[model samples]
Target: MTADTAVLPTLLTALRLPSIARNWKRIAEIADRDDWPAARLLATLLEIEVADRTSRRIQRHRDQSGLPAGKTFATFDFNVATGVRKNHLLALGTGDGWIETGDNLLIFGESGTGKSHAVAAIGDALIDAGRRVLFTRTTDMVQRLQSARRDLALAATLDKLDKYDLIILDDLSYVRKDQAETSVLFELISHRYERHSIAITANQPFSAWGDVFPDPAMTVASIDRLVHHATIIEMNGESYRKRVAVARVKGKDSASDN
Candidate 1:
C-alpha cells in the first residue's frame, strides 16, 4: 500500500460508511493526478450520494404523507420558537424529559408557523432512536374512524394506534367533527393518555377547538386529558411562507451579481 493511501483507508473505516470510503479512494486518485475537473466531478458525486442517504433516512422514519416532510428536530426553529418552558422542551427531548419518553406535545399556533414541522421532527427523531411512531392529520384520523366503524373492527384499529410509541396529529381543524368522530377521537386519546405520548399541531387556538368537536362538554374533556400531562408550544411569528419569500428575494439579488 502507498504511504499516502494507507492512512486514508484507516480514517474511512472510522467513518463507518464503506461505500463512502471507497468513493474517497477514487476522489483521492483524481486529486493526486491534478485532474481538477475530475476531482470536482467526484466531489459532486459524493455530495449527491450523501444527500440521498440522508433523505432516505429521514423519509424512512418520517410520515411523509401526513405532515411537512422537511420538519426535523435539527431544523426546527429554536430561536423565535417559544413553547411551554425552555426547561420543559429540553426535558421532552431528553430520556427523562416530560415529553421525552412519549409524553404528549401540543403545538398551537396560527397557520404557516412551524407547529406541524416541529412535532413531526420530534416524531422522526423518536423513530430513529428505535421508537415506533405514526403521523396522521386530524381529518385523516377521523376518516379512519368512519372506515373502521363501517368495517366492525374499530377496536382492532384502535389497538394499532396504541402500538406506536408516539402519534402525531397534525392540522387538527381540517374538518368539523361529529359526535361519532369526537367520541372516537376521545377514546383514542384516553387510551393513549399517559400510556404513550401524542404530538398535536393545530392552526386554531385551543379555545376555539369547540368548532371542531361542536359539543362544549366533550371538547373540554378531550382537552383535559391531552393537555393535563402535556407540554404546550405556542409559536409566535410571521408566516413561514413570508419568511421564505424574503429569503428567496435576497438570494436572487445576490446571484444576479455573479
Candidate 2:
C-alpha cells in the first residue's frame, strides 16, 4: 500500500469519520478499478458513510426503544383487530407527524385482544422511521419515577425522558391507586401534557379509571389531560388469543373423532 493509503485510516479517525474510515480503502479499490473521477469517488464514499451512520443511529434507537425487535406491523394480524383503523394507525406510526403536535394515543381493549401488540407494532414502525420511542409497563414506569422522586432526581429523569419523541405506557389499568406511585405517574402525564406524545394501552374504559388513581379529582384530571388531544382506539371484541385457543381445541377434537 502507498503512504497515502496507510495514512487514510488515521486521518479518517482524527476527522471522526468512522464509517468512511472502515470502508474507504475497499471502496477506493473499486473506484480506482473503474477509473472513476475524483468527484464521483468522493461523492460515493461520503454517501456510503452517510447511509451507514443513519443505519447505526437507527439501530441504537431501536435498542433503547424498549420495544421487542420483531414486533413489527407485518407480523400483526390486522384482521383480528377490526375496530382499529389501519390507515389512521399507519399514518401515526410513520413518526413525528402526530407526535410533533403533542397528540396522544389511547388504546383500549381487554387482555389478549392485541392491544399491546398493536402499540408495539406502531412503536417499531416509528423507531425504524428514525424516531425515538420508549415502551414501559404502567406500574414499572411509575415505580421508576417513584424511585427517582425518592432520590430527588425526578426532574433529571423526566428531563432525560424528554429526548424520546414518544413514550408507550402499557397496561394503564394495572397500576394501583397508591399515592406515591400514582403521583409520580400523574406528574409524568402532567409534565408531558401538550408537550410530548404518549401511547397508552388499557383494559378498562374511562368510566372505570377512577379505580386506577387514588384521588377521584386526580383521576378526572389525568383522564382530561390524556383525552384532551388523544386519538382513542377501542378494540371491543373477543380476545384474539381465546379464539385461537378455541380453534386449536376444535381441531384436536376433530382429529380424535376421525
Candidate 3:
C-alpha cells in the first residue's frame, strides 16, 4: 500500500518482466497466505514469468508463421498417408538441431495426397518447439520475391526470410516457368543452400521439374542444392480426398436405396 510499492510494477515493466509486473500482487498474497520463505516466493514469481513468456513467444511465432492453426500433426490422418514414416517425422518435429545444420525436407506426392498438410504439420511442430517457420504456397512466395526484385530490394527480402529457421514452400509444382518468378524462387533456394532449412512439397519428381523453371539448367541447379543434404519423403499414395469423397457418395447411395 506504500508509494514505493505502487512504483514496483513500473520498475518491473521497464525491466521487461511483464508477467511478474501483472501477477506479482496476487502471487505475493498467495505466498504470504502460505507463509512461504522469501526464496520460494521469488522463485515462484520467476517461474510464472518464464512460463508466460514462453507461451507468448510460441504464440507469436505461430501467428507469424502463416500456417493454418488447425493443421497440426495430431489432426493429420497417418493411415491415409501410408508412405510417411511416423518415427522419422516425429524426430524432425523435435526441431532437433538439424535445421541449424541446414538440412532440407522434400515431400513428393500427387495432387490431394496430403503433401501440403504433412509439411504444414511439421512446421507447426517446429513452431511449438521454439523454431521459426513460414508457410507459403510456391507461387505466392515466388511472386513476392519477384516483386522484391522489381523494387531492387531482393537481397533485403531474402535477408528477412533468413530470420526463419525453416521455410515451408507448399506446392512447389504450382510455380510456373516464368523466368522472373522462377529466377527469384531459384535465388531463394540457392541462397538458403547449406545455410537454412526448407520443407518443400511438390507434385512432380526431380526429372519433371523443368516445367517449374524455364531454364533446364536452373532446374537442375535448384534440385541439386535442395537435395544435397535433404530427407526425401515419398508420399505417392491414393489421394485421401478422393477416398473420402467416394465414401461419402456410397453412404448417400445406400441411404437412398434404403
Candidate 4:
C-alpha cells in the first residue's frame, strides 16, 4: 500500500471519526464497483460517522438514564390508564417544548396505578429524543442528597444533577416527613425550579403534601414551584397490577377446571 493509503486510518482516528475509519474501506470498495464520484464517497462516509456518533450518544444516555427497561410506550397499556391520553403522552415523549424550557411533569396516582411506568416510559422517550434524563426513586434520591448535605456537598450534588434535562423522582410520597429529608427535597425542587426540569410521581394530592414536607410553608412552596410551569398528569384508575394479578388467578382456576 502507498504511504497515503496507510496513513488514512490514522488520519480518521485523529479526526475522531471512528465510524468512517471502520467502514470506509468496505464503502470505498462499493463506491469503486458502483463507479461513484469522490464527493459521493466522502458524503457517505461523513453520513455514516454522524449516524454512528448519534447512536452511540443515545445508547450512552440510555445506559446512564436509570430508566427501567420494557417501560416504553409500546409496552405501556394505554387502555388501562385511560386518564392519560395516548396522544398527549406521545407528545410528551417527544420532549418538545416542555423539556427544552425546563418545565416539570407531575404525575399523581395511587399505588399500582401505573404512575411509575408512565413516567419511566416518558423518560425513555426523552432519552431517545437526545435529552438526558435520570430516573430515581424519591427516597433514594433524597438519601443521596441528604448524604451530600451531611458532607457539605449539597450544592455540588445538585449542580451535578443539572446535566440531566429531566430528573424523574418516582413515588415522591415515599420520602419520610422529616426536617433533613424534606429540607433537601425542598431544596432540589427550589434549585431546579424553572431553571431545570423535574418529573415527580406522587400518590397524594397537593392538599396532603403536608404529610411529605412536614412544614406547611415548605409544602406550599414546593407545590407552587412544581406546578408553576408543569404538565400535570392524573392517573386515577383501578390498579393495573391488581387487574393482571386477578387475571392470572382466574387463568389458574380455569386451568384447574379443565
TM-score of each: 0.67, 0.94, 0.94, 0.96
Instruction: For model 1, state the Cα shift of residue 123 in Å.
Output: 1.0
By lDDT, the candidates rank as 4, 3, 2, 1
Ten residues in a row with the worst lDDT in model 3? 173-182
Residue 94, candidate 4: how far off, in angstroms? 0.7
Deviation in angstroms for 185 in model 2? 1.0
Task: Give candidate 4 misplaced runs (Cα > 4 Å).
Answer: none
Q: What is the lDDT for 143 in model 4?
A: 89
Candidate 4 TM-score versus the reference:
0.96
Clashing pairs in 3: none
- For TM-score, candidate 1 versus 2, the one ahead is 2
Off by over 4 Å in 1: 1-68, 80-91, 99-102, 178-180, 250-258
lDDT by residue (135-195, candidate 2, tens digit) is 9998889989989999999999998999998999999999878546677888889989999
For model 1, residues 199-222, the per-residue Cα lDDT tens digits are: 888888878888777578878988
RMSD per prediction, one decimal? 10.0, 1.7, 1.6, 1.3
Q: Ten-residue segment with the worst summed lDDT in candidate 1?
A: 82-91
Q: What's model 3's TM-score?
A: 0.94
Model 3: how far residue 1 lies from native, Å: 2.2
Candidate 2, run of 10 with poorest lDDT: 176-185
Question: Number of backbone collisions per candidate, in order?
Answer: 3, 0, 0, 0
